[model samples]
Target: MTFDLRPWQLADFPAYQALITAPAIATAIGIDAKSTVSQQQAFENDLYQTYQAAILIDGVPQGSIVAYQRANELGEPLVNEADIAYFLSPAFWGHGIMTDVITAFIAQLPPHFTLWADVLADNIGSLRVLEKVGFTNHGTYIDLFGRQIIQFHLYR
Candidate 1:
């Protein structure tokens, strides 16, 4: 199915929260960093300033793609290296919904050398999605769960 991505709004929190509640997704995309409505509003306000959204499907709020710019050390600045994070309702898992959404989402970003994602070690389904989309396993990180998890990168 074709999905349309939109800018995430404060009102979208209810839908986003609902998305995070999905067992499979929550295990990866993380639970609310903002635990209150006021916090959600704060995140929404900051979202636009720091991030861009490419949401999936009209009226469904099925998922979102967030992009942001960050600086690095060692003096060499990188304009690329977009870090992507996404999730879908458990019901949509294994249906290639994310594969479609990602295809659409990547096209929206400026041409860059690579796309990166940090997936929870246990989120096998997400890893498969990225791999199916041509991402290669890169390295690992100590995520919130306090365990090392693999990271993926897809070069364009």
Candidate 2:
């Protein structure tokens, strides 16, 4: 299957919403399963401010990958470090689409920066995807929702 990554457009919101709201995707990413429209709107607003891209398969958006600067407790951005996050439609899971997307995305990023990804401990698929892309386990921590999160990082 041919795929491409491009900046998100307003028209992609519906596809993005569907991917993010999928039961497995929402739970793994800590999004409320019953998220309100306002909440989704707010989330979409935040996406526009970050380095985000829509993953298109046959010209339709089926996934997303984003990177945001890491922040300290004081809300200061950390230099040369960023946190990466991504999600794919459940229909496209188990096909290695995410692995290929991430590999391509990382290739286009500045090599001096370090990219970090936090995966819910129970998200075996995501954890494996990170491993496949050369991200090493950095540590683990508990998220606000009290879920076990494993941190992985790669030096580009």
Candidate 3:
């Protein structure tokens, strides 16, 4: 099973749209404003403008991880470092799916030394994922969309 990270494409809209609407997953990931097809189209189009990856299982798109960010407010300056937000279908959860996907991206991508992620403070599952993958807590955002979040990072 070769798990590779593919570039995001407009054709990924339907699968992504479906993932975004799954309530259990969406709520846990973050606020999901029910998006229209046009909105979804615009999103798929927009992501092409960034450094993103489609988590492909043997070349079939399973999920996506988006990398975007500014310099961290709570940490030292590290160029090419970024904050990321991403998701996969609940069906794809716990299959060592994201673990493999993230590790590969971090290795091949240009930001060789710095990476960070933030999750709601109450989101234990997400916190675990980040920690298991080597990110540590920086601090917390009192309310990101009305829920407090703990920031995590991997830096050298």
Model 3: weakest 10-residue lDDT segment is 37-46
Weakest ten-residue segment in model 2 by summed lDDT: 38-47
Of 1 and 2, the candidate ahead on TM-score is 2
lDDT of 1 by residue, 57-145 (tens): 65678776775444478745468766777767776677778887777777777776577788887777888888988999998879766
State residue 135's C-alpha deviation in candidate 3, in Å.
0.9
Q: Compute each candidate's TM-score over C-alphas.
A: 0.79, 0.90, 0.79
lDDT of 2 by residue, 1-156 (tens): 668999988766777777777888788777776767744773575467467888899898888888888889999998878889988888888899899999999988877989999999988999999999999999999999999999999997
Pick by lDDT: which candidate is best? 2
Better of 2 and 3 by lDDT: 2
Q: How many steric clashes does model 2 contain?
A: 0
Better of 1 and 2 by lDDT: 2
